[model samples]
Target: MSEEIKVQLTATPGEKPDSQKLGFGKYFTDHMFVMDYHKDKGWHDPRIVPYAPIVMDPAAMVFHYGQAVFEGMKAYLTDSGKVLLFRPDQNMQRLNCSNDRLGIPEIDGDFVIHAIKTLIEIDKSWIPTEKGTSLYIRPFIIATEPCLGVRSSYTYQLIVILSPVGAYYSGGLEPVKINVESDYTRAVRGGIGFAKAAGNYAASIKAQENAKKDGFSQVLWLDAIEKKYIEEVGSMNIFFKIGGKVITPAINGSILKGVTRSSVIALLQEWGVPVEERKLSIDEIFEASQQGLLEEVFGTGTAAVISPVGELHWKEHTMKINEGKIGELSQKLYDTITGLQSGNLPDTRNWTITF
Candidate 1:
C-alpha cells in the first residue's frame, strides 16, 4: 500500500440505501479517493475524503477544453462472503492510455488499484450483495489548470469514486433493440475515439438521446469517414455471430479498447471458438441477416457486462436477430463471465483480483 494516501474518516455516516432496489450510479458511498497533479510538483498528495461536491475554478481547462479521461471498473461481493475486483489493473492501465492520448499526466496504476481496495475495505458495507449487484468504481482525471487557452493544461486531478449499483440495463439479461446512429459520428481515424475521454461520450449524447426517444436502448456508431464500417456501440463494444463464427469491430483508432472485450476474446479462443476481430461493416451484417446467416448479437463492457442485442434498426430497415431473444452463446457467455466475477465458476485465467 502507498503511504502517501492520507485518510480522513467521516464523523457522521449516511444511511445506507436498500441493496435490493439499488439502481446504477444513483447512490454513493461515504468516502472517495483523490490525488492532484501539477507541472511543478508532478502527481502527489493522494488522500481519501468524504464524498462531496468538488470546488474548482470556473476557468478550469477541463471546463473549457474538456481535457479529461476516465475508466470504469467494478468490485463484486462473492457468494462466499469475499470481495473481488475484476481486471482493475487493466482498467487503470487503460486510464493511463487515455491520459497519454489527452496530454494529461499519468497516475500510478498499481497505487490507484491499491487505494481502491483500501477504500472498499473501509466502506465494505456499501457493497451491494443482491444477485447481479456490485460496487461500480469510476476512476477519472480532469484538467484543473485554470486557463481558457486551447492548449493542454499542466495541472490535473485524479479522482476515484464508488457507487453501489444494480444491473446496468433495466431489463437485465433481456435482449435490447439498438439503433445504428446515422446523424452524428463518434470518432474517425486519427481522432480521440480510442480513449475513454469525455469528449467522445459528449459527442454521442445526441444520438443516444435520439435513440432513446425512438425507444431503442442504445446507439451503435459507425466509422466517421466510410460511414458504413462499424465502430462501436455508444457504451459498449459490440459483437456478432454469423455463419458459425464470432466477429467484432476491429480495434481501429476509432474504437475504445475494452477490457471485457479482451477477456471475452480470450475465453472464446481458450475454448477453441472461432472468434475474429476485423472490420465487419453494417452492410455485410445486414446482408448476413438477409441471407439468414446472422445468428446472435451482443455487447461487452464494464457496466452492462454482456448485453444481448435482439433487434438492430438500420436506415429504414429493422433486422431481428436470433428470433428477437437472447442467443445460446449470449447466455453462456454472460453466465460464465458473471460466474467468474462472483467466484461461482472456475477462474482459470486469474482475471479476478480478490481483496
Candidate 2:
C-alpha cells in the first residue's frame, strides 16, 4: 500500500439533505474512498473519487457467494468546529478480523484510516452541526470476481461511503421494548456470527421483522444451540445491571465484539462499577427481576451508543426494567460517551481522534 492516494473531485455537487430530516443511512456525501485488490497487486490504486454507482459485473461473486463485510463509525463536529473520530482504529481492526473469517484479503488498517480521513476532509461540509447529529462512515469490501464457483475471489473492491445521519433518538433518550426470539436463530457456535459479514444481517431480518410486527423495537437473540442464553440484539450488544453489577455476554465466537461494548465496560470500570463478561441466561435475568435485583438493562453499539431497555417480552412474561424508565448508570454512560465524542468533555481516555 502506498501513502500516495489519487484524488478526483466531483464536477456537480449533489444537494445536501436537510440535517433535520437526515435519517440513518439515508443520504450520502459528495465523494467516497475506493481501492481495488487483485491477487498479483495485493491492494492498489487507492483513490478518492466522486460518489456514484459502482459498476460491477452481473455475475460478481458477491452476488452469488456473499463474501462481504462492513464497518460502521462516525465523525463528530465539535462546538469549536473541530472534526473528531471516535475509535476508528478499532473499527478497522475489526474489519480485518471479518475479512480473515470470510477468506478475503486483509487490508492495511492504518492506510485505510488515512484514506477515510482524506475522504471526510473532502466532504466535511456534509457533517451536521446539530446536537447528536454526525456523519456516519461505512467501509465495506466485496468480492468482485465474476465466477459462479464456490471459492474465495481473487478480485475485490473496498469502498468507503459517508452519510449524514441524525441521532438515533430524535428526542431525549427513550428506553425501548425488546422481544426475546426463540424460534429463529441468528448464529451458531463455530459459525460466522462474530464477523460483521453482510449475510449475518440478512439472516436476522426475518426475526427482526417478526419482532417489529409484535410492537417491539428490536429482537433479543439467544444462543443458537439452546436458545436460552442471551446472545445480543439484532443491531446491538446487550448488557444488564443486577445487584449493582453490570453483566454482558462474553464474546465466545458467537457474538460480535462491539467497539461501543468495550468502551462501556471501560467507562464502568473507570467509575469503579463492578462489571462482568460471561455467559448470561435470560432466565437469570428474569429471576433477577423477580428478586428485585435487576436495576438496568441496555444495548450498546455504534448507532445508538446506549439504548436503555425499558421492557423485555419473553414467553409468558413481560419484564419491566427500572420501572420502564432509563436507569441512572445508562444515562451517565450515554452522556459521558457523547460528551467525549462531541468534544464537550475532557478526553482523559484519548478515545477520540481529531483532524
Candidate 3:
C-alpha cells in the first residue's frame, strides 16, 4: 500500500465566479499541492495547502538562473459523471525527464502520482464540467537554495496547482493566425528546449509578445542556427498537412517531444493518414502554399489538443492555409482525441485513469 500523505486545507471564504470565459491559464483554484526536497532529508513535508504566495530568496537559483521545469495536463469530467486523467503516467515520466535535464532531484513517479491524486480529490469541486472546459493542472519544480551561484541548488520545491479554464480559442475553435519569426529562436542544439524548463519559455515570451502585437496569435519558431526549418509554435508542437500527407517536425534535440504530438502521429497512422516526421522547412511550406497544396497547419499540446493555424505571416509575406478555416483532418483529429479523453470513445490504449 502507498503511504498516506497528509494535507492541510484552508478554504477561501468567498471567491467570485470565473467570468473571463477565455481559457488559456487564467483562474487558479483555491488550493495547491507542495512538497520539499533537501540534501539530507530527501523529499518530505508533502501537503495540499492553500494557494498563496511563497517567500523565496532574491538570489535563489530559480530566480536568477531559471532552474525550473513544469508540466501541463488536465483533469476531465466525463458524461457519466466520473473525473478522469488522460495519460498522467506519461506526464510524470516526462517530468522526470525534465528534472534530469534541469539538474533537479528526482521524485518517485508513483509518489508524485499519489500526491496529484490526493490534491485532485481535495479540489475536485473546482473542476469545470462545461464543454471545452476542465481543470488545468500544472506540476513544477523550482530550485530554492539561497545562493548567488550558477550551479544547481541542493534544495528544491515541487508544487502542483489547478486552474479552471475554458476553450483555448476565444472565437470558438477558430483557426489561429501565426507569425513566422525569422530572427528570434526558441531552442537550439544541446539546449533545454526539449525539457519544459522555465528559461525556454522566458526566452520566447518577447517573440510571442511581438507576434501578438502584429495581430498574430503566436510565433511559429524556427531553428536557432539557420533560422530556416520550423521548430514549433509557442507552447505547442506544430503539424502541417500537404498533398494529403501529415508532416510534423521530428523530435530533434531542440523541439519538445509533446505527448499530444506523439498521440496524433499514432492515431493518424492507425487511420492510415500518410504521416511523415522530418525536418520541414519554412521555405518548402511557403512554396506548397503557393502551389495550393498546403491543406492545413495546426499545433498540438496539452492546453489545446489541436489548434489550427489558418495563416502565416513571414517577412511581410502572408500565406493563407485551408482558406482561413479549420481543415477536415484537423476536425477529425480533435474529435478523435477529445472523444478518447472524455470517455466518449473506446480507449484502446487505456489512456484514461478514473478517480
Residues 170-265, candidate 1: write the lDDT tens digits: 566989999998879998989999999999999889999999999999999988888999988877999999998999999989899999899889
What lDDT does candidate 1 reach at residue 287?
97
Better of 2 and 3 by lDDT: 2
Q: Which candidate leads in lDDT?
A: 2
TM-score of predicted structure 2:
0.99
Candidate 2, 197-254: lDDT as tens digits: 9999999999999998999999999998888899998779999999999999999998
Clashing pairs in 2: none
Question: Candidate 1, which segments miss by more than 4 Å at Cα?
Answer: 1-3
Residue pairs with backbone atoms closer than 3 Å in model 3 (clashes): none
Model 2: lDDT of residue 255: 94
TM-score of each: 0.97, 0.99, 0.96
Model 2 is weakest, by summed lDDT over 10 consecutive residues, at: 1-10
Higher-TM-score candidate of 1 and 2: 2
How far residue 320's Cα lies from its native spot in candidate 2, in Å, is 0.4
